[model samples]
Target: MLIIALSTNIAMLCLVSAVLQIVLPNDAPQWLIFGNIVVFVACVYYTYKAVTVWPDEEKAATIS
Candidate 1:
């Protein structure tokens, strides 16, 4: 579930970036920079969440 969320977020971010680049003027740096920051923060958040939910295969096998 978390992996799905992470991938979806990243994919959406890329789509947004592409759309913004096509629609926005070349001189506009602010929007692009802001988008980049938001994407970075989202990636960091998802990464942290993913690490927590990730299965510990080694520990599980040992326990079994």
Candidate 2:
């Protein structure tokens, strides 16, 4: 479901960000960090919206 998608997106973003930070030169630009922050924020917003709109039954099923 959407929650899973959002979580995966967040995880991928974090992984990519970490790899970029580790592999990029020490003097590399800050764009990678900024992009990671933006994507993370967007994912969190979408996850909040999905949770708020999800049906009670589905939420319960997810919890269990």
Candidate 3:
């Protein structure tokens, strides 16, 4: 769940940053865009990994 939240948060940040850039100065530093893309990709990659590794929910419910 934490990973899911993190994924969504990073996605949101990427969207917001991109949107803001439309109005931001043309001279804005280069690293901010690069950093956003890197973090967004990492978040999505990790979220996919975590979900695949998590135990089956249906199996756990059936045990009870």
Residue 41 CA error for candidate 1 (Å)? 0.4
Better of 1 and 2 by TM-score: 2
How many residue pairs collide in each prediction?
Answer: 0, 0, 0
The residue-by-residue lDDT of candidate 2 on 1-64, one tens digit each, is 8675866689577668856776777765678677776776677777777777777987789989
Top candidate (TM-score)? 3
Q: Write the per-residue lDDT of candidate 3 for residues 1-64, one digit (tens) a residue.
A: 8868878788778867865764677765668777777777787788788888888889989988
Model 2 ranges off by over 4 Å: 15-25, 58-64
Is 2 or 3 the stronger prediction by TM-score?
Answer: 3
Residue 45, model 1, lDDT: 72
Which residue segments of model 3 deviate by more than 4 Å? Answer: 22-25, 59-64
Cα error, candidate 3, residue 47 (Å): 1.0
Give candidate 1 misplaced runs (Cα > 4 Å). Answer: 1-28, 62-64
Residue pairs clashing, model 3: none
Residue 24 displacement in candidate 2 (angstroms) = 9.2
Model 1 Cα lDDT, one tens digit per residue, 1-64? 6675775678578657756766777765767657765775677677777778887999989989
